[model samples]
Target: MSSTLYAAGRAARQSGDLQGLIDAVPYARFLGIRSAAPESSALLQLPFREGLVGNPALPAIHGGVTAAFMENAALLCLLLRLDVLRMPKSVDFAIDYLRSGRPLTLYADAEISRVGSRVAHVSVRCWQDQVQQPIALARGHFLLEPAPESA
Candidate 1:
């Protein structure tokens, strides 16, 4: 993480603000990803825009954008739950496109499947209208910063 992002992350940690963290990431800002208020559920939203449409015929959000959104959700989840200053790096991510993503405000929530000493596993589900009917699902592995050892 750059010094600016590090500082932003630290400030967000202290104040429980997600926008600072999100704004620090350039790609997140370009994609227009935003989180619900901290008091609300940990749901990330990708608002609809003409630029995000991949297929004019289908009028669907690009597959890459969908995948990136899920990955962002997972990363943000880890950041919120982990006790580290530096952001985690993605090891690998696998995604399943269940259906064509309609050009609408998409929402995603990530579940932390497991957290080991240096690795965290996360799964994300994305939907527009119904949670039960997800448009995509993704699982990602992340490399976390090592925990400091006590003397």
Candidate 2:
């Protein structure tokens, strides 16, 4: 992990700094993903970019990019809720593409179904304008480990 991420994670752990947590991930930065603490849930935003389009004819965002965004959103949600500042490793990830993602700002939110001693399960949904109309849905299992004391 980058030192910048470490510091940002630390700051996020202490305060409810959603942006700090999002900035911790290099890929999140590249995707222009933003985090927000909504009244009810944690929300993730993905800004539209021409480079993200997979098919020029359809002008749709890549399925892989959408999946990655959903996964990262889940991880960020877990990090915010976790007591320890450690990186969670994905054990398994599954995504369902409901509809084609058009060239627009996308949003996502994660629901952590369960958290065991060593594993956590999360469900994520991504939408363009309305939450009812989702573009993709994802479920992921992650390995949770305690942070080193030396940190």
Per residue, candidate 1 scores C-alpha lDDT tens digits across 99-124 of: 99998999999999999988999999
- All candidates' lDDT scores? 0.84, 0.83
Q: Which residue pairs clash within candidate 1? A: none
After superposing candidate 1, which stretches have Cα over 4 Å from the reference? Answer: 146-151
Give a tens-digit lDDT track for model 2, residues 57-134.
998999988988999998888877764456788999999999999999889999899999889999999999899999
